[model samples]
Target: MKRQYLFSAFLAREKCLLYYQGTIRYVVVTADSGERIQLGLKHFQPYFSALGLRGRFRLTLTETGAFDSLEQIN
Candidate 1:
């Protein structure tokens, strides 16, 4: 049988911190409560274009409780 997972959503603000690790670029997300989540270049670029790294966003998690994706809420 196939297994299923649960997903969670939370509100977080876009926090852009551009940096390079050797050659790969990354962006990190910071919540108001002081939690941080780092995103990869592939993931960050697309959303950054749409959201522009400001305002509030709805953060979604994967079935395993890891950061999956985000969308602008405000």
Candidate 2:
């Protein structure tokens, strides 16, 4: 099995964090050839929508020695 990153996102309406236990299937390289992981939030749309989150939600990554926000992860 391929190594995958565990992700989490902040739900505004819930006023709390929503954890997404899933894997990133794609790896994107930057202009400098640095590898970056990409994860889609569509799978969690129902959960987020139910929480009344209209705008973009904040993502957080929870990995050993790799805990970071979405912006920092990229």
Candidate 3:
């Protein structure tokens, strides 16, 4: 069986008071009905910048959580 998830990814900036940096890049997504997935700057920046920033997308991942493909939804 194949497993898939629908998520809406968007760029977010989190404020950091302790660190020298003012904000950090983050990718936040609604993974399931009520689940949220967040990725740091290094994890999702490439994909988010290319397409995800626009709107929702369908994510296909392996059982081990490896990225397979991503398609933007209309």
On lDDT, the leading prediction is 3
lDDT string, candidate 2, 31-65, tens digits: 22233545444434555555643433234445553
Q: Between prediction 1 and prediction 3, which has the larger TM-score?
A: 3
Error of 3 at 8 (Å): 2.3
Highest TM-score model number: 3
The list of candidate 1 runs beyond 4 A from truth reads 1-24, 49-52
Which runs in model 3 stand beyond 4 Å of their true positions?
12-26, 39-52
lDDT, model 3: 0.54
TM of each candidate vs. truth: 0.46, 0.26, 0.50
Candidate 3 local Cα displacement, residue 7, angstroms: 2.2
lDDT of 1 by residue, 9-51 (tens): 2222233323222344554666655577655545444444433
How well does candidate 3 score on lDDT at residue 57? 68
Q: Where's the lowest-lDDT run of ten residues in candidate 3?
A: 11-20
Span of ten consecutive residues with least summed lDDT in model 1: 2-11
> What TM-score does structure 3 among the candidates reach?
0.50
Predicted candidate 2, C-alpha RMSD: 10.7
Model 3, range 1-74, lDDT digits (tens) per residue? 34567876654333222112625555466776666655444444434443224556676777777766667675
The all-Cα superposition gives candidate 1 an RMSD in Å to the true structure of 7.4
CA lDDT of each prediction against the hidden true structure: 0.47, 0.39, 0.54
